[model samples]
Target chain A: MRRIHILCVEDEPEVLEAVVRDLAPFEEVFPIEATATADEARRVVRDVILPRGELGLAICDHILPGEDGVSFMVHLHAQEATRATRKVLLTAQAGLQATIVAVNQAALSHYLAKPWNPDELVAVTRRLLTDYVLETQTNLYPFLSLLEADRLTERIRSGPLPGDE
Target chain B: MSIPIRPLDRIREALQSIPEAQSEVRDFVTGDVLLREGDNPGTISLIIRGEIELLKHAEDGDEYPLGTLRPGQLLGLLSLSSGNASFFTARAASEGTLLTMPDDRFVELLHNRIDFHQVVTPLLLGNLVDRYRRVVRLHLEVAELTRDLNAEKRQLQAAIDELEETRNRLVQQEKMATLGQLTAGIAHEINNPIASLSRAADLLHPQWHKVFGEGIERGLTPMFRQAFELGVTREPLQTEIQRQRTAELARLFPDLPRPLVRTLAQVNPESFAELRSAMQRVPESVRLSLLSQWAATFEAGVLVRNVRVAAERIGGIVGSLKSYSRQDKADEDAVDLRQGINDTLVLFGYVLKKFILVVDLPELPPVRCRPGEINQVWTNLILNACEAMGDTGTLWVCCGVRPPDQVWVRIQDSGPGVPRELREKIFESHFTTKQIACARGSGLGLGLAIARGIVEKHGGRITVSDAPEGGAIFTIFLPTGAAPD
Candidate 1:
């Protein structure tokens, strides 16, 4: 069974650390990764995470140093490997046009502004990850407790698990 | 006044009856000068066929056409009657025939023939009356023309005054706009850092007490002390490795809280393993308490760093602002054009997020100039380029020193290029390509005009042309030597 992962890309170190700390509760069930740049995030996606894990969610800040987060998210959406990764734009300065592109082209699922509420962020993450896992992953036991338990229970009872005879 | 034959026609008939008068008739083409001012021609010529021009010469030798003489009109009459030199020059304005009667014959005909006196008296009196009427008409025409010219001059002067007032108002408006931009930029720059500093300060107090309060009450072992210190020095984690390490820590400490596991992942791997080994020796509660302390200390360090970094950024922004406005420097200084460009870019850093900026600046010699004014030149060009490109295009700014004591800066963008016909007109004052809303609100049109003014004041030239990579390119050339005041 492939592990599901949540990724965060933020340029500011303090912000990145705060986001990672907020999402620490999901560390056991779904691994969470944080990178400070879009380039580093791309390398981690390509070289390390994709081999053993499916990227379930990506919460990205729009303003970054070299290549901005919107372009990176669009790139991710284009690739088959990470195409289904649920995208969220977490930014303070993404203008109207950039936000529109993120929504239309990058398939952005949510927009969380800066100074976000920790509980809301965790809830959104849980819901997105649950939606992704339910659609793709065959083994839903690990995520059952962290996600919407009632919904997972219904899915489990409605159909046999994949590879079951 | 009511003679059956006109007086001048009657005189011509009498003169033609004389046999000797036939020999006096002569034909002239156009432009023939029959009489010159100040010359005593000693003859009075009658225009028998076409027209002649009576011209008055000025002191400066310029000719003013007094009036025209048609057939039956006489020329040289003024000098002949006055017995002085002619005051008007007569020229054949078209193909014409004239009968010239010598002054002696003219006088003899008057003295010899009784009938001639009858014709001559009225002829002379009629000519005098005609001259007086022409002079009166000329005076009226001159008065009318002078009145019209005075009215036109007043209208022109009023227009010039209105234009001057408009120019002054625009200058004030532009200054206010620049001031507003600077204030907004400074406020934005200061706002971010202050927010970060406040947030960090707020978080530090509660977290700081949590770490030491729990650890001291629970009792800190020597190994716990060492682990806490080691954790404080831990390097920040790379994304991929941190993921692997978190999972590894979770597996080893299965009963540990997830936060502890995550915090432990940020620690040095060698120290983390030693801390884990030491943790096995302690009771579970004690171990958890010690790990919690480590996490708190680690967070405190991050908060402190954030505060320091934010403060430093604020300071940097203030420094850029000071340099950009030349607040602390003299009005004229030896300036690096590259620095001015960079500082202007810093002021626009917030707006430049949507643009891919390419800066190519080689080392340039210092130019003596008013640094603040030069910075305004850069600001206008860069802002215009950004506005032109809108969002998501490349902006190129290049600067270099040209030979013969001149430096040049070129700002170009990848957007719809300026139309060829509008290139010259764009620099005109109050001219703009943007829609009315943006132009009116932002003082949009005055930017390029002011830029041109500053450049010209510095003994330089600015020009616009098509960029090589398809957009508008504005280039400014300034003298490297001292700029004139």
Candidate 2:
């Protein structure tokens, strides 16, 4: 089974934990990874998650201690390995200018404000991860329980079924 | 007014008719005293040419000019009539000539020569009337001079009052500006904590339900209990370390589910090993169930931690804000400036994220000050330094006490420093380097001027110098004693 991971980048550890826990419904299949800083997130991408599997989603806080979340997303977008990673900016204080940068430069897939609705976060995650699976992964059965089941089913039906050799 | 006859010529003519036996002419130069105030000259003198000034000698012996006597004015008339010594010191005011006759001869002339008496009588009376009119003119001139002096004094007083009011307004305006900035910065600083607060609040119930309300067996499992304790204490493992631990666990428990192994690997090292050992006692089928229960309690702990941290952050900021604003404070508050500086730094928490802040604020002695006003100075200087540095730079802040007298705060930035020539003008009201190039609203530092005002109000002073590297170093020195109001 091809693994897909959800990466969370937030400087606040407690907030990071809440966000990770909120998305725990998908954790069994997705194996969510958390990092405290943009620099650490980049290191995780380079050293651990990318070599093992594809990063299906990156949910980031826009205001951070060092490099802001939008800039990191843009950097990720510019990279070949993680170019297609679905990006989301989650923050309470990101101004319109930051949003524009996230959108125009990083192709931000979603903008989630702080104190996010858990169901909405899950739904967005499932939808975007499902998109990631369809675009990047040929295998879909493993993620069927956690992802967008209807879309995955449609994708499966449109394609030739895997034959037992 | 009728011009008096050139008295020098008439006095000379009158002298010519005096008996040659009784009269003699004399010449005297400037500063020559014709008669000392108390001297008893046996000869009565008349000015034959030039003018003599009558002078009164003060008790200190300083001569004060009483009036000028032209050539026809008699030098000894008062004394000669009253049969006393000369009543005033008679000093020659210019190059002149005089006629003198013995008092007896002068008396004989007055008795025997009616023509001489006629010539002298009106001349004496006219001189008396002229002197009386001069006294009246002088009193009016003195009154007008006094009125002019009083007007000047009042004008000076009004100017001083206006200056004092302007200084006060500058302080108030800067305070309003500081409050504006303070509210903005405080709002931004409060957001992250607020987010944590709301999110933690939302998660609290769900986490509680999962731990105690769900299926009884799962919640009661020994594995769940240990995981709950471990989660309550442990910080999240870094991704890199988790990866290493996960690789090792995957090798040791090749038969176990990969996801379960990954979850187990994320606990602290001791707990990870202990849980792995405990899991060895459980059947593979039940281990996944136990892991689920364990992860729930861990999450509850993390949420509890989040709420705790968020509340603490909010509380700290409020305390700092209270100290920083010091609202409704009408009198000088004795405070350690370092405390206010710390509070100001707290308010600037969000903005300071972009800089490498090095703060060395040691404990300082308390000084009498308006705490809120002093805080404004710190905010302005720190912000101005940040603005000068733009997006990112190093900031060095330190405090010092010059023992028993004064204390100082120094804030330095790593930005393009003020040009040497403009340094003096930078603190002037409305002074900005960008005035010619940028719009008035975008101009850089109204705060510096306000900062200067607040400092000066405390009887303290603020100055900016170039940092060792190219940047501004602003230092504020404050008196430890009572500052003048």
lDDT of 1 by residue, A1-165 (tens): 578888899977668888988898887777777888788899888876799888999999988866789989999999998899999999988877788889999999999998899999999998888889888977777888889888788888888766779
Worst 10 contiguous positions by lDDT, candidate 2 chain B: B435-444
TM-score of chain A of 2: 0.95
Per-residue error (Å), model 2, residue B133: 46
Clashes of each: 0, 0
Clashing pairs in 2: none
Q: Name the regions of candidate 1 deviating beyond 4 angstroms.
A: A80-83, A137-141, A150-165, B1-262, B268-289, B318-343, B350-374, B383-450, B458-485
Model 1 agreement with the true structure over B1-485: per-residue lDDT tens digits: 36444655456667777865432778999999999888999887777788989899899979899888887667877787789998888898999898788887777877887776776666666666778899999899999999999999999998986786578546744664576478667767786777777666557545554655555543554444455445434456666677788888878778877667777777776876776676677787666776677666655555555555656676666667767776323356778888878888987786675578899999988887887778888888888887887656889999887886898999998988898899888887768877764521265577787788778878899999987669989999989894433
TM-score of each: 0.56, 0.63
Q: Which stretches of candidate 2 lie over 4 Å from their true place?
A: A137-142, A156-165, B1-226, B235-266, B282-285, B433-444, B482-485
Query: What is the per-residue lDDT of model 2 for residues B33-85, given as tens digits with 9 covering 90 to 100?
Result: 88888887777777768888888889997879888887666667676778888
Tell me candidate 2's interface RMSD. Answer: 4.2
For the predicted complex of model 1, DockQ is: 0.16
